[model samples]
Target: MSFPDFAKVIAALPSDDAEWGPRNTAPEGVPAILNNAPYAPYSKGDKLGRMADWTTDSSKDGRDGQRGGRQAYNRNFRDQQVYGAGASSLFSLQHAEDEATFSVVDNQRTSTKTRGGFGRGGGTVFRGGRGGRGGQVTARGGRGGAQGGRGGRGGRDDRYGGGRGGRGGRRFGWRDFDKPQRLRDASVNIKPDWKLLEEIDFSRLSKLNLETDEGEDVESYGSLYYYDKQYDKITPKGPEKRLQISERAYYNPTTSEDPVIQQLAERDEATIFATDQILSMLMCAPRSVNPWDILILRQGNKVFLDKREGAGFEFVSVNENAIDPPMDPTDGNKESINAPQALSLEATFINLNFAHQVVSESEERKFSFENENPFYNPSEETEPLASKGYKYRRFDLSVSEEEPVHIIVRTEVDAVIKSPVGKGDQFMTIKALNEFDDKAQGAGGAPNWRDKLVSQKGAVIATEMKNNSCKLARWATQAILAKADLMKIGFVSRANPKDAGKHVILGVSGYKPREFANQMNLNLANGWGIVRTIVDMCRNMSDGKYVLVKDPNKTVLRLYEVPFNTFDEDLEAREPVAEEDEE
Candidate 1:
């Protein structure tokens, strides 16, 4: 049904007046407020009707459900005519009367206040107290002995003359403290053309594919249904499917004829042997790996693995340079040239399964070298080469739990060439190991190794600031000064001449005045006076005659000493020379 027709049915329902109550049970046709209206003056004690008992058979035997019984009146039908006419008319009349009376009083009071006139009596003004008057007091003219003096011209009229004139009251200007005038300008009216605004077509705008003159392509519009269907259809036929198939075939070949198939078979056998070797080595001797020795090679370098006469092997190499000595006889001996010089190296070692194939076939063949002389002897050999240093010097490797490799390198100064390969220049002795051996424990002893693995996988060295090198230096300096009983003031020295003598200079035993000025560029930029100032401050405080001035606002303490007049000339007379030469 239409909405209006449904609403009309709702409006026609019978109201509360149709029920039998005091108002409805009033005498039907009686006039003159008579007929002893029985329902009038209604009270709770009045008997209306007998209560029904649901436990009796009248309700349960289906007799109550028949026609012309109580069920007839209980039908879902309402008589609107019996109650609608009087109830609506009486409410409307009373509401109209209340509105009419309220409007008259409200209008009258609004008119009175808006006119700015007070009712009947007017305002009044009152005058205040008068001005003060001055009066003279005179004692009785003399005594009887001085009667003549008492009558002397009525005491020459010594009474005060009159009161001073009252000052006029202040009068204020009417314009003072007046509110600014308000201009009567019209408000701006901006009427929008609502018809020009387009109605939003959400369905068309949100469509995944829009049909233009171009051909069909992948739709980029954000439609969940379209994306889901497109992904479902494309995924299985994509590149990932090919990758999975290839990986499975490479790991588990179907036939031994395939090269990959043979490799897989060999790899499985090799893995078993390698595991046994690692276990045997670990059990052979209780050994510890040094973390510092496990160095990460820098970019553009190579590692060479050298085989010893026995099964024990070591890795080393000269990276990005010639291993043999230079041809020039005057260039110095080989040991002198390679005297424990710091060189960055890079290297990588991977299992055959993970290693990339070498492009050159000849190089690959060279890499596959092997010796099978199991009963080989070494005593029947030519002259043995003198032991100059470690056969293998540097090693770089990455070790994991699944494939652990032990690495150890001698960092001590004597580990390099022990004998002088050169006459004048003795071969520098690179130490093999030092006393701090316990501090060289590797990753197994590291407390944060697990955290480092999760958060910073390949970061071997902690950041510079994390090492606290500078902080430790400062702390050590302060400790030395404290132990020496010297005043410790935490002040940053300035590089300017004007800031000299403002901060204390410590550890100035071998500090040259010229070097300080040159390093700071104070001679050409600021002046040589900064050097003089620093020297004077240092000399005066050398005898421990200085006062500590504490800053009230901060924790810093400033040490001050008396200035010396001859300090400037003394620094100026010094000659310019290299600081290292002076040392």
Candidate 2:
């Protein structure tokens, strides 16, 4: 009664037809299989967990179920081959309608459900949201959100702004993950009492457009030396000419600090004042990605657009709007030499010297303006004055018969070139584009200047137009502001990619300012509209100092009401501390 004899039991069972094993029956013409019935190949190592498993159907548990089934079976029997797996797609179910046509409706309201906090109904604190890269937090909900029904007790709201399409989780834009998150500090410190009057994004600024007539010259100062045609003849061919550093005096004063603009403001020549540099920055702001601040000082009816002592606007940016812009100097990165800051400095130096070196310094060849240089002092300045001319121009920005707005901008001319068509001497604005390393990150896929500047010049220029859109736009704007007949762009690149110290000139290309603006799709009307909008904002406000700051991470401009003594106090505070440190 314990057990049956193994040999007797095996002998008694039918040897030809075993019930638990492969059948021995064969079809008439079948070569592979012994059984006439359909057969599935089995491996010795296959995990035969169940004779009939039912949970693997995708319809039963959704797509997750199919994934789980694959995971479970694959993990246990990875080496085991399944028969008829190739034709398994034939058994899969087909949908009656396209999946793309279907949509999901999320009707979740703003979560006003309160949390534990010190408030009438507990308060909800929002730590971060879209465009909050710098760890900015907002406290909402609780008693305050009760009326809005978008936060607080019994209200359905998200931590971020809640609406039908509230972004509740991490928000990403096109290819946002390719670059590291950046948090930039403001140009000027923000005091607790400063009030934010306006916050405008690039979208709004880009949409603004207003046509204005050519500005009339109010006054002119300084002198412009004739541009030497010899430099233009040089090509980026066999032997490259090294870019020489010149020791010449060049004046680049800010708007509010300029005595000429101050005098114009005092005389009430215009309701608004700005320098070409600052004006160009505001005009080309929609294309910029770097952080910059423009100081708006209002006295009675006049508003002046100015810059800080050493603003980022002073230096020309390189590949700022590229998908992967030049990174900051990190600890161990060797390519940090091509960092945005370093490139800007090198480009700035190249421009300063290129303008001076290209122009003929002869007094006889130079053309004098209506007045002498306002900022230049012959005795105080040891270096010879670089060729430059400034013109104070005024444009009308009146909306209707009642409101007449005028803005005076001090525009600069680098030099003058003889008209190619023989229509007298033509005014010109000179700027140089420097190449750091074409192979470097954030090079914006630019070609090697030495190789391409001579043959594939159009390709080089097109790439530059894409990579340095903001910088080129600013230059063109400045040229137009000055009413320059020609805009000269010089191609300059480092002698060696690894060495940022030395550079060489490739060649020069010239284009009319108006024509160049059109090529870059730079809408002067939009720029004028931006100026008018900002002027209107200041004109409506009480007379005070205001600062317009560009958000680094996002395309936004925020205007803050600053105390009259904010920057002055900061300078004063630093002076004493600096003196003490010196002691």
Model 2: CA > 4 A from native: 1-179, 573-583
C-alpha lDDT of all candidate models, in order = 0.20, 0.75
lDDT by residue for model 1 (1-583), tens: 4677546535544467645333432233323353333332323343333333222232222322223323223334223112122122222212223332353334321111121111112111011111111112222221111111111112110111111121211111223255233221111111232111112122321222211121111111100000011112222122321100011001111121223213423433211111111111111111111001110111112111111111121111111111121112223322222211211110111111111111111322221103211122346534321111111111112223474322221111110111234532111111000011001111111112222323442231122112222221222222221121111111111122132112111110111223322332221111112112222333333332222222222322233332222123444555444454688
Q: In each prediction, how many residue pairs overlap at the backbone (N, C-alpha, C within less than 3 A)?
A: 9, 8
TM-score of each: 0.12, 0.70
Model 1 TM-score is 0.12
Worst 10-residue lDDT window, candidate 2: 163-172
> Candidate 2, residue 387: CA error in Å?
0.6
Best by TM-score: 2
lDDT, residue 580, model 2: 91
Clashing pairs in 1: 412-430, 412-431, 412-432, 413-429, 413-430, 413-431, 414-430, 414-431, 415-430
> Which 10-residue window in model 1 sums to the lowest lDDT?
430-439
